[model samples]
Target: QQQVRQSPQSLTVWEGGTTVLTCSYEDSTFNYFPWYQQFPGEGPALLISILSVSDKKEDGRFTTFFNKREKKLSLHIIDSQPGDSATYFCAASMSNYNVLYFGSGTKLTVEP
Candidate 1:
């Protein structure tokens, strides 16, 4: 069974607008949340991450808001741009485990 889940299978936004992707997990043991961005024909790259102890994390235009109590989180992309269009994946893993459970990615398109 998949422990991580993402919503809105796909999304489209205009340049300069912001987009939000929601994710949830079933495993309470998962404490580390990482968001990855993938471009066509390329492997996913680590975008940003947050620990269970953190309520929020931000890096430049990307931010992740986590709710440990609810085992849910959301990634926000600010100042959306055409170059930012890609498949965004939210993943979770246990502190001691190397395996990461990834949610169904949200394909985002930033139209100019």
Candidate 2:
């Protein structure tokens, strides 16, 4: 079974600080990696993603560092703000597989 795991299930950061979330997966067949952010009563929204062929992907203040060999990845949130508080889920899927395996999630709180 494909499984994804995340550490420090919850995190707290001061505004303007950086937040880091760690995630790991079991399946080597997984190719696509995506991170989603969900707020109360709202569906998750894609934050950033990276391919197996890529080691790092960044957009604005969000960055995903991937390690294909170890089947691990880390999501970094820079310049954190109070509005950034949310639950983040790390997910992985294969190009041919329609299912996405997601980590438990990391709830982040940014203190202003």
User: How do the residues 1-112 of candidate 2 rate in per-residue lDDT, one tens digit apiece?
Assistant: 5399998799999999999999999888999999999999999999999999999999999999999888899999999999999999999999898888899999999999
Runs of candidate 2 with Cα error greater than 4 angstroms are none
- At residue 100, candidate 2 shows an lDDT of 84
RMSD for each of the candidates = 0.5, 1.0
lDDT of each: 0.95, 0.94
Please report how far candidate 2 places residue 75 from its true position, in Å.
Answer: 0.5
Error of 2 at 104 (Å): 0.3
- The sequence of per-residue lDDT tens digits that candidate 1 reaches over residues 1-112 is 9889999899999999999999999999999999999999999999999999999999999999999888899999999999999999999999999999999999999999
Number of clashes recorded per candidate: 0, 0
Pairs clashing within candidate 2: none
